[model samples]
Each structure stands twice: as structure tokens, then as C-alpha cells.
Target: MSLRYTFINVLVSIALLSSCSTPKGITYMQGMFEEMPQEIIQQSRITVQPDDKLSIVVSSKDPELAEVFNLAVARHQVGQSITNNNNMQQTALFTVSPSGFINYPVIGEIYIAGLNRQEVAQLIQKELISQNLLKDPVVTVEFMNTTVSVLGDVSHPGEYPIDRDDLNVIQAISKAGDLNITGLRENVLVVRKKDEKNIAYRLDLTNAQSLFQSPAFYLRQNDIVYVEPNNMKKRQSTVNGNTVQTPSLWISIISLLTTISVLVFK
Candidate 1:
């Protein structure tokens, strides 16, 4: 064969070989087909925190008394009204005071901060019995406005409702449509509010072991998950169906082109 034809044949073979090679660090290609560890499943519980709006319901032999408690709990729902009168106003959901108490009808001032919905319901049930409000009161609690914020490198970024108490980092990410390819999988950051202070935790999803040891693996109410972009994605943003690239993005583009050329030629 002529040298020119031989070079083309070799290039095509190299290209085909390179295309078949599995990318490094990909979970599917790595031999990890077993089920996740038991410890990971056990460590997925998330406790409730302060400033979390909850719906507390109480029932009793006397529905009237239960209705009173329900009404009291409903009063705690906070928000504002905007009318065509052109007036705009905003209001808080639950107003837990610095003393950790909220004013409830008949129950008076009750401490609710730092308590989960179930605990709050139990407390209210005890209060009703002690106050002679009802006999054998049954209580139920639900999070009325519990939400967590998802940001950075997700299909949809915004606050999502906390429907269940067992929501974890992976489920939260899934709720926001999972991380984009450009997202940093090994270094996701979760910001939370604890003890009237802001705290942050780093998570590594790439390692199966990290699923058990990482504190951020379980999501808390008002928790913020931020998926930083990979190095190449940080410098580029797509708008109007066009890619806007910075110096770093251009470098990555050139590197990719060079890789394609080398694999084809070799």
C-alpha cells in the first residue's frame, strides 16, 4: 500500500481503539456492581432544626377541643398579602421568639424551637390533658413550609419542599434533577444552619465509603447544596444557543481537539 493510504488506515484503527477505551474514574466501567454498604442506609436520617415551620394537629374525644388546637397551630402559618391596591407586604411563617416560645390559643406561650413535629405534637397533647382541654388527645404534626435550597450545576435550582423526614443528599439532588455533567462530583458542599450559626460540610460522592461517613449525605431543612462546576465549565456559560468561553475554556477546547487528533493519527 502507498504511505498515504497506510497512514489513513492506521489513523482509523487508532480512532476506533481510543473510542472503545473506558474513561477513568467512571463508576460503571470500574468493577463496582455490588449493593451499597448497610452503614450507608442506616446513616440517612435527618433531624429537624429551628426556624422550620410545622403544622401541628391535635385530636381528642372532643373534636371541638381538637379543632381549637388545630386553629391555634394554623395561626402560626406566616406570610404576607399583596393586593391590586398596589400594596406589597411580607410576613414570617412561624414566629418563634428568642425565648423559644410561640403564642398559641388556649395553650398560651409554648416552647417549640429545636423540636421536631412529632415532639411538638406530643407536647401539645400533654398540654391539652393537663389543662383539661380534652381527654386522651391524639396529635399529628407536619412540616408546613419546610424547604431546602439546591444551587449550582443542577437542571433546576431552587427551594424544594421537604415532604418526608428521610430526605438525604442524593434524593435532594435527584429532586433538583441531579447534577449536570460539569458538576464537581467529588467535592459537593452542603451549607446548614445549626445552633443559630451557619456550618458547611463537604461530600465525596465518587467513593462508596464516603456515603456512610459524610455528614452532608443526609439533608436538613434549609440545607443548601452547592455543586461547583468543573474546571472547564467554570469559565464557560451557554446563552442564546451559543457558548461563551473564557481563556480557560479555550484551553480545554484546544486540549480536547489535540487529543482527538493524536488518537486519530496514532
Candidate 2:
């Protein structure tokens, strides 16, 4: 074969191989058998933290008796004109103090941080019974402003509210429209704040065992999940697209090959 034809064949082969190459560690929960081990499966719960807003409601057999224990709804005029004004009522939200205490209607200050929603409800129920305020009180507690932020290499990165108590890392990612193709699944980062200190944990989505064993698997309120971009993606972000696998590099190589072909023929 001629030298020019040999060189052209090699370039075409290289381009074909590069185009066929697929990224590794993209599939999640790999190496799973028919049934997962019971020990590996863990249940996670959401715990209340400082600065969390809570909505606590107390109910009893008698509606009138329960009304006093619950926070009264705040009402405000909606329209600017007096004739067209409408009264709008909104649920009163209780912000947990930095010291983990919330001022209840009659019970005053109650420390509730680190407790789950059910535990908070039980505590309030006990308080009402102990104070002889309600004979059969049923208290319900819910997180008002708890959310987790998902950023970097996600389809739709944003802050997602934790609607349920047991929102896991997988679910949180799904909420953000899952990670993009260029996301680095091997080293997904979860940043959590506890005791005024920020702690970071890395989880490998490719390994089910490692992901399940991670403490940050169950995301907490205000947690941040960051999916770092792969090496190729990082390179593409640069002005020059500095990588042999990049499209720009491939274009330059094709241009060089075309020039060599013309010179060889001429």
C-alpha cells in the first residue's frame, strides 16, 4: 500500500475507535445478584436541625379544645383597594431557634432538634396530656422549609424540597432529573452540615454495597449533592477543548490529514 493511503486508513481507524468508546462507571448499582443481602439494606430517617421550619398541628375529639394549642393562622388583606380587598389566611410556621428550641403556644420553649417528625409529634402530644390541656390530643409535625440542593452535571440542578421523611440520595438525584452522561458517578459528593460543621462524604453509585453503607446515602435537610463532571467534560469547558478525544481536536486532525493528502497527490 502507498504511504498516503496507509496514513489515511490509520487516521480513519483511530476516529472510529474513539467514536465507539464508552465511559466506564456510568451504570449505577452494578454487580447485583437476584436478591440483595438483608444486612446491606438500610432505612434512613430525616432528623430535625437548627433553623428548620416546622408545622405542628394539634387535634382532639373536640375541635374547639385543640384550636388553642395550635398556632393561629395569620390573615392579611390581599388587594390594594379597600373595596376589592380579600382576606388571605396562611399557616403559621415555627422556626427552630439556633439552640434547638421552638416556642409552643402554651408549652413555651421545647427543645426538638435531632428528633424525627413522629418523635416531635409524640413529644408535643405528651406535653399536652401532662399539662391536662387535652384529654385525647393527637399532634402532627411536618417539615416546612427543608430542602436539598443538587448541583453539577445534573440534568436539572436545583434545590428540591424533601416532601417525605426518608428521601434517599438516589431519590434526590432523580428529583434533579438524574445525573447527565458526563457526570462522574464513581465519586458523587454529599455535603452535610452538622453541629455547625460541614462534613463531606463520597459515594460510588457503581457499587451498591458502598453506596448503601454510606451514612450520607440518606440526605438530610440543607444537604448538597454534587456530581462532578468527567475528564472529557472538564476538558470541553476549557477555551481550547484541550484533549485528544475532543471534537475540536478531531477536526484539527482531519484538517491536517486533508492537507497532507492534497500535498501527496499534487
The top-ranked prediction according to TM-score is: 2
Tell how far residue 94 is off in model 2, in angstroms: 1.5
- Which lDDT value does model 1 have at 254? 51
lDDT of 1 by residue, 150-246 (tens): 9999899899987887787888888999888888877889998877789999877776576556677777788999989886675555442224333
Q: What is the TM-score of each candidate against the true structure?
A: 0.67, 0.82
List per-prediction Cα lDDT, in the order shown. Answer: 0.68, 0.86
Clashes of each: 1, 0
- TM-score, cand. 1 vs. native: 0.67
In model 2, where do residues sit more than 4 Å from their true spots? 1-19, 34-43, 78-88, 246-266
**Tens-digit lDDT track for model 2 on 52-133?**
9998888899999898877766555447742332344345889999999999987899999889999999999998999999
Which parts of model 1 are misplaced by more than 4 Å? 1-21, 24-48, 72-94, 237-266
